[model samples]
Target chain A: MKVAVVGAGSIGLLYAIRTQEAGHEVTLFVRREQQIELICNKGIQVEGESMMYDIHVKNIMDISGAFDLIIIATKQTHVKKIVELVKVNEIVAPLLFLQNGMGHIEDIHEIINPTAIGIIEHGARKLSDRTVAHTGVGVTRIAAVTMKQEDLIIYKQMLESSHFPYKLENDWFEVMSDKLIINAVINPLTSIFKVVNGEVVNNPNLFRIAKKLCEEACDALGKASVEYHLDRVKKVAMQTKDNHSSMLEDIKNGRRTEIEGISGYLLKRANDELPYTTFVYEGVQAMQQMDRREYE
Target chain B: MKVAVVGAGSIGLLYAIRTQEAGHEVTLFVRREQQIELICNKGIQVEGESMMYDIHVKNIMDISGAFDLIIIATKQTHVKKIVELVKVNEIVAPLLFLQNGMGHIEDIHEIINPTAIGIIEHGARKLSDRTVAHTGVGVTRIAAVTMKQEDLIIYKQMLESSHFPYKLENDWFEVMSDKLIINAVINPLTSIFKVVNGEVVNNPNLFRIAKKLCEEACDALGKASVEYHLDRVKKVAMQTKDNHSSMLEDIKNGRRTEIEGISGYLLKRANDELPYTTFVYEGVQAMQQMDRREYE
Candidate 1:
């Protein structure tokens, strides 16, 4: 089986290495030409693992050939661009999106392929252009977005391996919302406060704010889901205690964040006032707009 | 005129030094016995001044004598405690309160003393126990909280000098609200973003949030006050660009912030929903709850 992972980020790199370990040919798609040079030359180094895998990597714009599975692991902000460039034989290939937030769910209709929305519970971090870390081990859960049960099974069997496990959910909306709630709570709070993921729930002050965010997010979903979402938020935060959230890393490195897709998306979906959501949405946006190093 | 300035903080030290420079007998009432010891032993060293004044400094608990003027230079959070401890001859010693926010305004009625609320525009930082740096020069504006105009004039003349000046406003409510609005926009934003006072407006990202905060603050005030308040926010932010806001300084040192008096006060007075105010209020509150140094 051939797997095409359309991102060279933490998740993309992790999946590319893991899928190859499962005896599949994995091609890692990256946005930058520099990442291509570095990855092809140095191969890829995964933390805690002694060996480096000399995996094949290419620019997303130069992607070609048939893939048994295509995983869109880019930040939700870049999903649209990936779809525009990498829409090759979508009818035959099963499209799986592992991007954070619910923004790409809207764009799933653009591909005529069998699509599945996946939530990567595994904690992964891109240490550098050619290095990655599997910070926390968790299963990948995918739900059929447009794929039928039979088609889903074929791709699931090909994608899931012993070390790189996968779980399929019946309801795509439910699983994605669960992930969305978790991301909405953890990402921006960690980003704004400049703390590791664990502190969001571990610190009492942050927990207070995190709970408020959870409640705001669950408002649209109704109160029934509040406890469940809040519990997941706390659990995931602690599970990835030391890892800097992707959004926090973005802010720290002066890159654009996924606030637009996470908190921003939730803000737009809620019918009533989402003061907490709106505050963080604008807060993260404000962070994206300024480079504090100049002041320093 | 003999003057008593309580609290050894930036404002307290500034006023104590300036009052002495005006040829007034000044006693600095500090909370810590250590501060009293330090100030009395080595005296205060103010930035840009060559001579160190061996000024009279005493513990706040040891406060005595009927001073001609009593100024509460403590934080708004400490006003109640100061009022509780130093309930000196309020009627005779015209008490002028120089603290940020309107939280202390409510406690003024508990005293029979002629009280005036003042907004200090001077950018002062206590570099050490007894040393302070006057980073920016601005006037002190006072409005009578309980005192009559005639009594305010006496203290204004006694306290104001060539280096330190004072202005009087007719309506204390308006001036205090204007200051509160400025504080609400500047304090928490600077504190949360960990930027200096000027970055709140000078940084485009922060300026966006600052504008929203000013609008939410002026919501109950109506549209007439929006531009005026925003212009003031920007002007003050730029004027004090090099200076860290008191709230920012408090957070940095792990000291208690006056968020309760500043953003917290405005939040309570607001009639409509203030997303920006509530966000910052809770954000600063959360900051108070957690010490990130443990995680560090």
Candidate 2:
């Protein structure tokens, strides 16, 4: 199976390395020339609990060759860019998107391919240009957004391994909506408070705010199944207490956040039903804008 | 005239010294034995424009004898404590409350005496036990919460001076509400961002948040007169950009913030109408709690 992981971020790199380790040809589609050069010269470093090996994989700036799978591992903010690249290259392989929020699902609908949505539970951080720290090992849940049986079997063959497990689900909406509730609650609160995931749970007041946000997200999404999202959010926070959410890392690194996709998306769907969600969405947006201005 | 300034904080000390300089017998009623000893031995140091002097004034731990005017210059959190002290001491004089938020106005109503509310525009910071830096000189607005003509004349005589101007207003609610909106916008935003007052205006996103908060505050208070509060807030932020707000200073010093009096008060009145105010109010409250826990 030929697999290409778009976006050189931690998640992208993690999937590319793990897929290659599972006995498949993997190519990393990265935007930076420096990252491409570094990865090509020194290979890629995967450090942490799941793996600790440097593997060589093909790295490219353009989407040239056809592959069995093209994982869109970029942020939801960059999903449109990846879509543009895919359209320009006219690659028709199965497209699997691993993004934080539900906003990119609309964009994925427009792509002309056997599309799938993925929720990557693994906690990974990019250490350097060609190094990734797989902080935690969790299952990746993938579902057919618009899938074919042949494409699904190919993805399962390439993604499943003893160390990196991939579960196929029937309903992508349910999977992504659950993931959205979790991210919508944890990401903005941690980013605004500038605390680690654990602190959001450790501090009682912060935990209350997080719970309120989770409840608001559940209500906004109208998902009765995720009514207990507050507990799930706390569990995740405790499980990854030392880890900073991707949004917090983005703000810290002076990068554009996926707040527009997460909280901003919820705020738009909420209309006026969730005031707390709207307030938090606006606050995080302002913080992101301020951070971008400071970086510039 | 005998004037007593309770609570040996920056504002208390400033008013005490200024009254003394205006030829009134002034006494500072403080809580700490150390502050009493420091002030008795070395006097209070007032630094900044309009005056820089080491003036001698009587400092005592207990409320001794009767005073012509009693200025309650403590933080709003301590207003109830001061009220208790007044009840215990059975001191009967014209009481003047100088604190943030309108919550203290109800607390002042409990006191059985001629009372007035003051909005101190002077930006003062306590540098040491016996030193205060009067950072900026702005006119102090005084209005009768419950007062008599004789008491007002006495307060004017003691507090009004060429260096320290005191303007008396007929409507204390309007005066305090205006000041409340200003503090509600500036204090919490500055403390949460951990920035000086000026950055609240300099950052466009922060300024937008400030504007939104001002509008919410105006709506919550039902004050169409202050619809232009956004401009007022920006002007105040620009004027005091170099200085940290009292709330920001409190958070930095690990002291209890006046958030309960300002944003908390607004949140209570906003009920369900002002979601942004409630969100910011909760966030600042959590930060205060975190700071307290860390200090402990």
Question: Which candidate should be chosen as best, given DockQ against the real structure?
Answer: 1
lDDT of 1 at B277: 80
| Tens digits of lDDT, candidate 1, A84-183 | 7656533367788988888877788887778898888887878898788897788999889888977887777877777778897899888888788899
Q: Model 1 residue A252 lDDT?
A: 81
In model 1, what is chain B's TM-score? Answer: 0.93
Question: How many residue pairs clash in all the candidates, one count each?
Answer: 1, 1
The lowest-lDDT stretch of 10 consecutive residues in candidate 1 chain B is B85-94
Candidate 2, DockQ score (0 to 1): 0.42
Minimal lDDT window, size 10, model 2 chain A: A52-61
lDDT of 2 by residue, B1-296 (tens): 87788888888888888888888887788878777777777777686444543443444446768788888888899888788878788888889899988777667888797899889898788888777888878888988888975667667866688879988888888899999999999999888777778877887767767877888899888878554787888889899877888888887777889888898888778745575676678788788777343221
Runs of candidate 1 exceeding 4 Å displacement: A31-54, A88-92, A127-131, A220-224, A294-296, B32-46, B50-54, B88-92, B127-132, B219-224, B271-273, B294-296
Clash pairs, candidate 1, are B90-B113
Every candidate's lDDT = 0.82, 0.79
Off by over 4 Å in 2: A48-60, A291-296, B48-60, B271-273, B291-296
Could you say which candidate leads in TM-score?
A: 2
Error of 1 at A231 (Å): 2.5
Write candidate 1's Cα lDDT for B1-296 as tens digits.
Answer: 77888888888888888888889888888878888888889888798789787888887777778888888888888889878775652335768888887788788888877888888878788889888999878899988978989888877887787778999898888888888888888989989988878777766667878888899877744447698889998888888787778788788878999998877777777787776787788788888777666334
